[model samples]
Target: MATQVTFSEVKNNGLGYWGVLGFFGLLVLGGVFAFLHMHEGHYTTGMNNQVVWGIPHVFAIFLIVAASGAANIATIGTVFGQDVYKPQGRLSLALAGSLLFGGLVVLLLDLGSLGHVIEMAKGALNFKSIFAWNMILYSGFLLIITLYNWTMMDRRKIAKKLYKPLGIVNMAWRFMLTMGTGSIFGFLVARQYYDAAILAPLFIVSSYVFGTAIYSLVLMASFKLTGRDLGDIVLNRLRNSMAVYLVLVLFFEMTRHLTNLYATEHHAVEAYILTGDSIFTSLFWYGQIILGSLVPMFLVWCRFFKNNRLAHVTAAVLAVIGGMIQIYVILIGGQSFPLILFPNAEVSSAFFDGVNNAYTATMSEYLLGIGGVGLAVALVIVGMKGLRLLPTSLADDVIDPLNLEKK
Candidate 1:
């Protein structure tokens, strides 16, 4: 048997490390702006009745989607019987749990009341509400994944037997959680841009793409920073997987928009996203397509730089940047367009009813969104420092002996 890879805690012994932590701390301080919004009211933010969800939702939803995707790494090892991925199991689990927590923090802060959340926790919730269902799903996901991660680390025979079942359950639950999240927008009946069934599956595939990208970057950075060896075999496997996911995500996007464009009723929203000179158009074309998809794809698939480490980093960074732009377009751009309340007649009202309502994000919204990202990074840092999350090395000879065996 291959020598079982050992897990060790990251060394927390540098000014550079402290500086990174301080940077995340500054981001968390941005939450003071969130507190101001909460105390003063939603009026303080760009969100109004029309654009009910703003930049915060963009960040929160992305983090949540990425969280679900991050868990895929562990699932490949435990559920798929892929021993090549087994060494990555612990770090994957830690990142998944931490990302979810960060997202939930942003989401909860955005809610109307802290007391309402307390009440909901006390079982004063509407089970019929998708929001409530998500709360359950999110909470249950954390609990089950924590247990699952524990089982993976436990060597007791009882824990071993329980491990596979828990892994299967974790996978199923995460799918449900992400599907529920997509349904938040997918089920918006009043919104012309949102009422599509494809959003759920699209979100699922998107989670895979964005989540894998984040994981690959974190893995590389962690290894490099800690002076550990991470091999080309693993990097190639991960980047290739990300490339496949990117293609799938692009397919889903084409299906979504093409299906929408086929209907005359959907033409206006498509025009807003694809043809207009607005920020949404630029973000979709440049950020999502060019920088996010095409460029990263080239970096990974290019034969000349297949094994180059810098190529891997560039692809991962661009993939993450593109993922953010995609979410922003979906959340804010979808809301930015006028609602077609009267199909046959032009309408106007004080609430900007049936007209394109501009959502100009304020400093507070930007800070809060940045804070959400900061929260995720902070959680990752803390997990690495506090737990035995990082492995000593992932050199090809150490982790990829299975390939030799197969040959």
Candidate 2:
């Protein structure tokens, strides 16, 4: 830490005692919720047949995307030998490992049954279903990251040696993860998803943006809370990266929308989401556009503003805040409107018939998601405390942080 910190330096290492307290408190919320759901069944989760994959899906997807993106920061150094990016690399790596684990916890909990939790390992060999492979792929993804990032008392030096290989491998692994996730939506030939070929590329691109954004913001907060100076150079470069990502993410989203509009039947699900009723519009306009897009863009791209640190931090925060909403719109919003086009006329599945099928998340579902994040937070905080996640040899505002990977 840049500043002198003490044991009583505030709860959870300046994340605010309240933040940590609440975070832990949620475990209680989740536990109580889980108990209720397990006893009563999944009738409380806000899920319907049309919206089967709700917020938990969005949350789970967010972790995976963010997890992969976190590792990309490591590439800037290990693969490219650009150490100016190194200051943020450790945090990126740590969070990547933590988020992947957290996401798995959330996803498995959503399944509502732990029948195949271990069988998830056997899934990759199947190759019959892309989703099946994800069971194994993400597991390996987390493993490689953990092994590469974790500090082994005896193997610490040896582990660092793997950085270079891990860099390139990390890139490839992320490619697989994104492709696997996209395939979940893309390869639905039985439905309109057959035309979702473009979705995979967009998913990868979005991961880059959202992942970097979240890590950047979290690091900024870490610095400020820990009393470290980010220096102008580091902040400037990060802001530049955020600005670039924000613009690129916008391009990807816009392009996807246009493509969906131009093609026949492809527009069926997405169209309703982009230009639909209150639910979708509110999330897109208020959540995506406002929280995710325009605000961050203006802040990061402002020429007159020399406050790179603030710009960097704000942009990163907005990127995650907006990206979170964006992912929700894509994942949950994508599911909100089911696939139903009878031969006679256009149709939407806002509700189910015959009986009120219970699609809600129930208590257990939310608890699992909460617990996953809690696990991540606890792990991250402990990692930070143990390893001093802050730059140890780094000086604040140095002209260059020294490219560890390059030289």
Candidate 3:
């Protein structure tokens, strides 16, 4: 039988829908806290002169990275002609746009000079600034994704003809976006934690793991909530893919750190990551490595989780948490370690130039960061209700195999 891939809106309007919406609604209030901080000054938050980026950056950067990764579903379908992933193509584009917007919201809100954002935008662009190039990349992403969506959703032969080429364009665009975002840190030579060229590809790999984990969770949850059958066939494919991404993340992280450790100057930063204070050590070893990497890999490959829905959901949640922790370790941990201004001798200055800086994130920062995630979730929820994003059914037999040689 030919696959009947009819797109449909979620018809359910039960307590679950409203409850989730309400949860995200509360998260939006974090914007108010952010605004207050912006008005009062950044001093009220955990961010000091030393630790400039803080947790808000950690959240914003992760969502933005995952946003690029989320496009991989559509890339797999249109670019490679994978029929199984085609059903997910529309929602992937929608999530990509929404998640990027949400992360942008948190990032803009956290800026000390929120009003100056417009002034800066109006000014001439500096080609040398990675930040300036990112502004262009992000704006272009929204436009391209919108056009891609129109092609996928509109039932016109001309639009259908446009989908494949546009999909290829989007695939390439997302790669550039990931590369630019990673280069934001990688290009920073003064910072010992971020000078490695490997960071660009590492960001790409991380996006793969984070994006897939989030898409899996959202897919499974949306289907189950609306009483749809997401087949083992599809779930297993995603589960396996996520496991491989997790492995790739581990490999890249090890390679990056090992390469850094070889340089004498990088030792201080490495020590901070490996044997720092209780919080840093716990987040790196326990959160990033243990919860983020090893545990999820175990769950993905475990005999008990094979074909088990509960196991897949649990693993997905763990992966998301792990992704966040990894970002936290990289962003916060990088700044927490004292910059080596005077390599020859012990140094002290008003900026705490040669000593490990103490940073304790305030409730406001936490609200703003967590709210960014909530904002992304809210966007997905609203988008589903407003558009035909989900497939009517994803049963094993209902989807057409791309080729006759079936797995």
Q: Give the TM-scores of the predictions, in the order they appear.
A: 0.95, 0.82, 0.96
Quote model 3's TM-score. Answer: 0.96
Could you give the candidate ranking by lDDT, starting with the highest?
1, 3, 2
lDDT per residue as tens, model 1, 1-407: 22457788888688867787888889988875665665588888888888889888888899899999999998998999887677887888888887888888888788777666677668799877888899989999999888888887777998889889999999999899999999998988878789998999999999988889999988998898788998887788789899889999899999999999999999988998999878999999999989999899999999988789899999999999999999999998999888888887788887788777788877787778778888888888888888788888888877866656331
Q: Lowest lDDT 10-mer window, candidate 1? A: 398-407
RMSD of each: 1.8, 5.0, 1.8
Better of 2 and 3 by TM-score: 3
Which stretch of 10 consecutive residues in model 2 shows the poorest summed lDDT? Answer: 1-10
Instruction: Point out where model 3 deviates above 4 Å.
Output: 1-3, 400-407
lDDT of each: 0.86, 0.65, 0.85
lDDT of 3 by residue, 1-407 (tens): 22477878877798898898888878878766665765688878888888899888888999999999888888988899877888899888888887898888888888877788887678868889999889889999999999999999998999989999999999999999999999998998888899878889999989988888989988998898888877777888888888999999999999999998999989878887888674778998898889888888899899877888888888888988999989888888888777777786898877677877778888888888778888888888998988999998887767744534253
At residue 316, give the lDDT of candidate 3.
84
Per-residue lDDT tens digits for candidate 2, residues 1-407, read 21221111112544474575467557646744664464444566676556667666777887787788777777675677665665556677788888787777677666755665566555435678787789778878877776655531124677767766766777788889987886787886544433467677767777777777767766666666666556655566566676676777777777777877786666656656666563666888887777777787788778766665666667678778787788776666555554554533654444452222333455456676666666666666666766645563334424253432211
By TM-score, the better pick of 1 and 2 is 1
Cα misplacement distance, residue 328 of candidate 3 (Å): 0.8
lDDT at 235, model 3:
84
